[model samples]
Target: MSTLVQLVLAMLTGGAFSTIVHAVMNRRRSNAEAAQIIAEAAASLVGPLNERLGQHEQRIQVLEAENAHKTTLLDEAIGFIRDLLAWAGRLLPGERTPDIPDTLRDELQL
Candidate 1:
């Protein structure tokens, strides 16, 4: 009877140990799988994300170039209008409009 009890106790202890080890192994495998899935997902996103970023960079460059061109044209238009204003001021009867400021002349290279 004592031997029988000891046998049963041994079996229970072995089963418990095996269960704990199995649980630990399963948890490790799950963690590894989760990490792999996340890595794969990030890897999948990299290509499209980089492509979109490149496209945005190109669009930004185009917009910057257009802005620069428009700014140049606007500056020229402003210079022309200033010159016209100076010419018109000379013909007017009232006090002559002040000459273009030296700063504006220097900036416009007029």
Candidate 2:
């Protein structure tokens, strides 16, 4: 009877040990899968955000270049208009508008 009881105890202990080990292995596998999923999600999100950020930077550069060109053009136009107005003011009231002044052509950087 004692031997029979020992046998049953031994079987239960072996089953319990195997169950614990199996549970631990399953948990490890699940954790690895979770980590992989997290890494993939991060990579996916980062890839597009990085691409968009690059595109935005390029767009900003283009806009800045356009602004500079516009500013230069506006400055030239303002300078020309000011010179023309000053030259016109110098004319006699009834004088026909004179030919475009040499000073204006000379001063124009274009």
Candidate 3:
């Protein structure tokens, strides 16, 4: 009787231990699966966002280059206008007083 009781108790203890182990393993598996799902979602988002960022950077570079070109042209135009005005000023006779309108002189600072 004592030997039979000992065997039954041993069997019960082994079953309980196995159940606990199975529960722990199942929990770990679920946690790992959740982590994998989150990682995959983040990875999926990375590709499209990276592509968009690259496109935006390229656009900004293009706009900056265009702005630089326009600024250079504007500077050249201003210089050309200044040169023409200086040439005109030099051609006019210095001693002879030209008829200058008061408003025009004030506006042009002549």
For model 3, name the residue pairs that clash.
none
For each candidate, the alpha-carbon lDDT, in order, equals 0.78, 0.76, 0.73
Per-residue C-alpha lDDT of model 1 across residues 33-86, encoded as one tens digit per residue: 999999999989998999999999999999999999999998888888777776
lDDT of 1 at 54: 99
Indicate the TM-score of model 3: 0.68
Candidate 1 versus the native: TM-score?
0.63
Estimate the overall C-alpha local distance difference test score of candidate 3.
0.73
- In terms of TM-score, which candidate is strongest? 3
- Model 1 deviation from native, Cα RMSD in Å: 8.7
Candidate 3 local lDDT, residue 99: 54
Worst 10 residues of 2 by lDDT: 1-10
Structural similarity to truth (TM-score) of each candidate: 0.63, 0.63, 0.68
- Candidate 2 per-residue lDDT, tens place, 1-110, comes to 24465456558786575556666767999999999999999999999999999999999999999999999997888697777756776765556654556766555533
Model 1 residue 51 distance off true place after TM-score fit, in angstroms = 1.6
Error of 2 at 106 (Å): 26
The numbered model that scores best in lDDT is 1
- Model 3 poorest ten-residue lDDT run: 101-110
Candidate 2 lDDT score relative to the true structure: 0.76
lDDT digits (tens) for residues 1-110 of candidate 3: 24465456558786575556666767999999999999999999998999999999999999999999999987786667556556777887464545556644443444
